[model samples]
Target: MNDECDFCRIVAGEKSAHVLYEDERTVAVLDQHPAVTGHSLVVPRSHEEEVLTIDEATTTAVFETLRCVADALETALDPDGFSVFHTSGPLVGTVEHAHVHLVPRFADDDVTLSLSRDRLDPDDAAELTARVRDAL
Candidate 1:
């Protein structure tokens, strides 16, 4: 874990967080600045800057914890829906440590989390699919 990272500090118990769950591999905590009341973040104990660079075991642990936490949020909050997401890279997100956001959504909330609604042309879609499939 990087000493300079805030999440690393929280993981190390050098700093305090409203942690909801913890095991040998990962930790889940309430987001200090939540998008909704039950917003939480699941983070791996080992420092990983992004999901694409992490090992398979850590990735599994993180998402498994996310699922467990999501279930808990659902039972406790009984929201209309839920949103599980992550932000990677420096361009569009702030936190450097890899984490997943589990947001509980209510029916009447005036909030919308969406990406561009633009539809790609068929040829462009095919080209993108080919690039991704070939890379895999």
Candidate 2:
């Protein structure tokens, strides 16, 4: 963990958060600026700027924490469904540390989380797929 990251401070117990869950590998806490009620963030203990760049064990721990927090949100809030997501890159206002948002969604809520449905050219799709597979 690093000193500069706010999440690291929270993980280190130097800062206060509405902590939902914690273990050796990860921590889950309520989002102060929630999109909806019962919105939470699952963060890994180790400091990594990107989730994809983290080791497999830490990645696994993040997913496990996400599942646990989602289940807890279901039992407590009983939302219609969930919108589990996260933001990345400097263009968006994302925190430096890697985290996953587990947002509890209600059918009546106004918030809409969506992606553009632009059509992808077949050749572009195939090339992109090959590039990703080769990188893996």
Candidate 3:
């Protein structure tokens, strides 16, 4: 583990974090500065500088853990929806380890989407979904 990384500190129990879930491969914890009430972070136990740097096994494990935590968050918080995102830039204020952000959204909350009043057509959405699935 990198001694300078915040995630490393948390994983080492050298820092305080509101942990949600943990396993051999990953850990989920509440975000200190939450975008929503139930905003949380999902990270791998191993320290990797970026998502692309993680091994295939670790990457798969991280995503699987994320899905489980997301389901639990939906059931527990009952948010209107949620978003999962990851940042990989070293200068973007992202920690030096790969992680996913799970931000719960409420209908009346401040979190807003970039999409305007014009909605995507169902066919377009279907095509996009197909492309994403193909990529995966």
Ranking by lDDT: 2, 1, 3
In the range 23-122, model 3's lDDT, one tens digit per residue, is: 8989999999987898999889888878777999999988898889889999999988888888778656557788998999888888754545787899
Give the per-residue lDDT of model 2 (tens digit) for 9-125: 999999999999999999999998998999899999988888878899999999999998899889999999999887788997558999998999998987788768988899999
- Lowest lDDT sum, 10 consecutive residues, model 3, at 111-120
In each prediction, how many residue pairs overlap at the backbone (N, C-alpha, C within less than 3 A)?
0, 0, 0
Q: Pick the candidate with the highest lDDT.
A: 2
Of 1 and 2, the candidate ranking higher by lDDT: 2
Candidate 2 structure lDDT: 0.91
- The candidate that wins on TM-score is 1
RMSD (CA, Å), candidate 2 to true, equals 1.4
Error of 2 at 94 (Å): 3.9
Alpha-carbon lDDT, every model? 0.90, 0.91, 0.87
Scored against the true structure, residue 80 in model 3 reaches a CA lDDT of 84
Q: What TM-score fits each model? A: 0.94, 0.92, 0.79
- Tens digits of per-residue lDDT for model 1, 3-103: 99989999999989999999999999999999889899999999888976889999999999988988898899999999888888888698889899888
